[model samples]
Target: MSTWLLPESLADILPAEARRIEELRRSLLDLYRTYGFELVAPPLIEYLDSLLSGTGGDLNLRTCKLVDQLSGRTVGVRADMTPQVSRIDAHLLNRAGVTRLCYCGSVLHARPAGLLSDRELLQIGAEIFGHAGFEADIEIIELALASVRRAGVAQARLDLNHPGVPRAIVDSDAALAGASEEVYDLLSTKDVPGLRALQARYPGLRPETTEALTALASLYGGTETIARARRVLPALPALHRALDDLQALVAALPGHEFSVDLADMGSGYGYHSGVVFSIYAQGWHDALVRGGRYDGVGKAFGRARPATGFSLDLRKLSGGLPPAGKAQAIRAPWGADADLVAALRRLRDEGEIVIQMLPGQPQRLDEFTVDRELVLDDGTWKVRAI
Candidate 1:
């Protein structure tokens, strides 16, 4: 019934919140820059094939697609900026060494992915291309932590996992190989009964593999979890390597609260091949920042390279920060006095916000806080703080 109403989960950001979000965006971009991440602004829309390239099936499902009037081919409004950045690195830049890229913009989702998730998100992140060691993973995770600290969310919790852990366990067991998706869902949701049923299906599998598959459901919490995993999990090469990587990450991030969770896999499992992480602040129910190693994400672009990055919702991160101070406004009366015009121009040049009143119009204090007023005192124009 309301013609001017916004679509569900899509709403306008008014001036106050918009200003705060902008400030946070600038701060984050600056942080990324200090770490050698060059700023990149990818177009909001692109061909469906490229947008979904190497991103994963889940992204395709989340993207909002439309037919291009000029090309007659299906295109999609980006639901994520990572793949676009991957294309830039793999196809456009074609650089062999490590290339650091950062981006901040809105991505439209076909539907809200979570209860409070927006159809449009102001996503900001940094990606590192061409490094494939545990050191690269450590760097990105530390950078993400520093970003949260920079955003004023000091009490942040980091959760780390390697999807390879579960993949190794599942693949090692022949009976469970085909039903990995069902098994993953059960583990992700902590469905104990379903996992028990799964273990029952593979009656003749090796004791260690079966034990590890069932143990995945409970491998969560502090450093002790990693220790427990090393003890319980089979010594398969992939599984051991995943545990070692997680251990190395924990050792690097000293003085920060973190957990080793094998069951923390999400929809991006196929895309993020190693060392997944999510950061949570004290007040937020959802992750303030998330990323991990999606090495070889550039494969589809024809030159596969190791890549890892993290993104945070500007609005959500700003929501956890203290309110920003309002800019001081100096109210100036309309006049032809050369001195007054000169003073107004000087103030503007000095980065002051001066609101000039219209000729014969009344001053509206409600429109802005008049911190000061420009007036003629003793035949000389001056600015006096109220």
Candidate 2:
């Protein structure tokens, strides 16, 4: 028998790291609760149709699938929580007007091109359904920003964009409808040469459409870059609306570094109807959080509600963050008394790492394998140094 190992992209979370992740999750969840968002946990597996209802392209490819033996139908491991949550809002919750929901869970998916991480990742995010206007969009963006800040992501930058740039092009031309997916991917990567080849193949398209496509190609930079982009597509109303929405969002997040990426930078999820954004920290090349508005996706599942939310890649954040706390041994005195057990239980309940001594074993802080120590002496509990 060959014993090579587990897959390279997959990994296990050790005790210390897992504990830190759980602590971070609890802290963020508590913060989200303060903002009136109720938490929900959707099942990790669902009908393939429900999970892929509005998710598209890269997301669909990343999903892991299996056939249910009992039902004789295909089901998929949830690759992302947003689509699952959207399905929940549509089918289960069906909270007619509007609903605010948050979720924290692990998602499994195939790795995407250029992505270096595991197929299984832990995510924490929220979805706001049933609000349609720009005001609603702004609120979601602000919350996404605040959530990242609360996670101790110092020097976080928000990059905002709208899928409408390509949507406008595709909607204006009947021939482009089926080709929108290919065009969006090319534009997102700023593949100007490939875009030009597409334009050449579809010469009947309007010059304005080509200009919009070309403008989108060179639209990545800071605030001044956005202004420069405005000049390139001065007459595109959709572009202007997206720009205005971004401006308002930036204004709301004053003193926080924010920029507009006019490129076709959004995931091609059919549900994302308006502005989309990603958050990045100083040293990480990938976004720690990604979210946007998906106002019409709920409609496909039978309810017509507007929705927006974001997910934090917990693994990515943990990798980038400093070590949670210093490592040290934990010690606790051993005694044959009910009070000692009660105190040990209380310490464990409070989330302190503790080690209990065996009978006849001396309690030395250094001998215990934990961060802190507790001593029970004369009906009093004291924390001792290792």
* Predicted model with the maximum lDDT: 1
lDDT of 1 at 255: 80
Tell me the TM-score of model 2.
0.86
Pairs with backbone N, CA or C atoms under 3 Å apart (clashes), candidate 1: none
| lDDT string, candidate 2, 1-386, tens digits | 35756675788876667777887889889988988999999998888888887666777788888998989899999888887788788888877677889999988867643467667788898888887766766777778878777767887888887776667666777657678778888888888888777767886776667667877788887877667766877456776776776776666666767677777465535557777888888867677788888776766688767788888777778878876664454567667667767877887787776666687866544322565668765768877765
Task: Tell me the TM-score of each prediction against the true structure.
Answer: 0.90, 0.86
lDDT of 2: 0.76
Instruction: Please give the TM-score that candidate 1 achieves against the real structure.
Output: 0.90
lDDT of each: 0.84, 0.76
Q: Find the candidate with the highest TM-score and give its number.
A: 1
